[model samples]
Target: MHAFVVGVAHYPYVGKGLGTGPARRLLDDLGQVTVPEPSAREIAEWLLTAPRQPDDPPIGTVEVLISAPHPVKVRASGGAPVEVESAVHENFRAAFRRWLRRCEASRDNVAIFYFCGHGWRHGDQLLLLEDLGEDPELVLANSVDLGVLRARMHLTGPRLQAYFVDACREVPMDLTLSGSRPRALVDVPEPDGPLHPVDAPVFFSTAMGHSAFGDGGAATPYTEGVIAALEGLGACRKGGQWAVTTSSLAAHLQNIIDWNQVGEGNQEVRIEGQWAGRGVLHSLAGAPMVPFRIGCSPPGTPLPERVTARAMISPSPVSSVQVFEANQGHLSAGFYEIDVAYPPDSRFTGDTILWQIDPPNEVLSLTVRSRLPDRS
Candidate 1:
């Protein structure tokens, strides 16, 4: 497999003192933040080092392009001024084109593309690059169109291609939020004929036109969720084997972003593809760890008669507390949920609940709080 990761943290013309103050103000109003360059490094490192299936071949090459303002003091005749350095703006296109050519010849490997940056959607997703557009006019000349790239990748016959984007598609001054949720779905022409063979799966950090927030000291919420899923935080077993696939990873990421208050439901992750079965990305090498999913109201949130909950346990969960038994006959094995309705007068007193599993028995504790008396 081949992996290419791009992270852009500094835009020359979109921010402070660049003759485009309005653009910066709009970005701030829309909740845009500078993406951390370490995110690119971390993702590339994982792609290079993540455990692959036991029989899968090693990744041939991992390419990374971190686009950020690395200050370099340049001495001039009058004085010294600082210049920003970036390789993505200088060589990324040529390097990627070369790789695309190679893909035409090879035709049988997996490919991964990850981009974390500022972007806008105008008929297509446009990745903002380093070039300084006409200030105030703000023509997006130095940008990459995601749709065009996807179409190009379709021509290259790789077994699988995966794309991850962490960017807001909202254009400045574009207040309309109608049709803001970005969808990666592809429509079919007919009902049952042979569909187009575009074996690419994509994951977007935010719904259409929404901003993807960045953490000050950590990776963006989206990348953090991806890292957690890849690290087996929410892994599930299938057919007695511990593994992470595109489907499972997507589900885990969505659950994390939605249930953990990661982005308060603003930064929703969406995954789209058409693979018949789960596409395995990594295999847990005999690690005796039980992966499970849990979701409910936070500890202090109001308690309802019917608190909805869902779970997926790998390697068989022994038992559960404050919940029902696992239905072994489920079409999708290892999946369980809690939909029990409590009596109207039932008394509850506790700060937490427990979920216990075995083999390497571990208990997961979830804090809870009853609804406070109504204040007049």
Candidate 2:
């Protein structure tokens, strides 16, 4: 069985006063990112279940986590030096290692981890911020090392380790430091591996070397696409390993329309014995218990009659739905009789009909289908 887990750290306060915008955005939209213990069990059950297809595995498990959505963790050291150009001296923080510790209680056939937020590089070493500290020495990127993170994880049997990084800076690691203790950066050997499709002999782990960019019109595009891919694996094609191909993942995420560009694959990073591939991430992107609602104001456009018009009435669907100009078609579904505008759209003529359903990938399909005369 495969298991995935997550821990997050955040930094809310930047240079000045506290604001609600950034954190509030995460209120309902915080995607399920952590792999809990029960979730891990369930995943294993999925892989072991009788195969619906003789060639397919019946059960599988995956875990994911995203933290500090409500608030990026912040802390201050008693006497840390502050830049004179800086407006606010506040520092936010998150308990990533602690949460990771819980996730790593026991490793599986395959495990993946992801860390976002701020990172600094000193020499070849990379450091993720825990919180603010007065001691300037604590800020050194070398203080943390990838090998240390690997040792802290509870990888029991034979398994692959794939580390991904977005943090950009490099820092020197003092081999003498406690977390600096070096371990082999390779896969773990689990004697229990089933050798069948159930066991993921090939697993990839990723860490963004430098992903400190601020959230904007778009959240983390890479992360967003990654989550969508994991959430909709049924929509993906399977190679040897379970993967959501990059093109489809990008298309799913593109629906949000906030991102300007979408990246494809990670090249150059090497994992021992694992084939190099793009569009694959080792982080666990788990499904949420409930559907998350995301609401945003439409981009520069004339005010529609209703607030949810853009979401409710697609641009293309209105054309095939023709109604007498005077006797506008009425929908039996909701209290609000949405005022249908003309020109690009057709009016309804037949008995008022409305199906409470989500729009398909191409709203134009509905219009095209409606234009054809009734087959009956």
TM-score of each: 0.64, 0.35
Clashes of 2: 55
Candidate 1 on 1-376: residue-level lDDT in tens?
7776777776655534433344435333432245547666668667766667765545776656666666322222244432323534445576566556655456567677888877877776777655534243343445676776776667554756778888877755532222122222222223254434645778888777777767674577778767766666445676677666676676667765554463465667766654533666666664434333433346544333443334446765445423423311112222344343434554442333323342211223334445465589
Task: Score each candidate by Cα lDDT.
Answer: 0.56, 0.30
Worst 10 residues of 2 by lDDT: 84-93
- TM-score of candidate 1 versus the correct structure, residues matched by position: 0.64
Error of 1 at 77 (Å): 44
List ranges where model 2 is wrong by over 4 Å. Answer: 1-108, 123-125, 132-134, 141-143, 150-158, 161-212, 216-219, 232-236, 239-376
Please write out the lDDT profile of model 2 over residues 1-376, one tens digit for every residue.
2333322333332223222332222122222222221222222233233123333221243333333433221112333422211101121112323334434444432344444433443333333333212122332221244444444343432233333333334232332231322122234455464332111112112222422322342334434433433444213334543333333333343342232232533322212223223333222232211121211123322222221211134434433232223321222121121233323344221222233422112111111112334579
Off by over 4 Å in 1: 16-33, 71-90, 132-138, 172-196, 238-240, 258-265, 273-277, 287-376
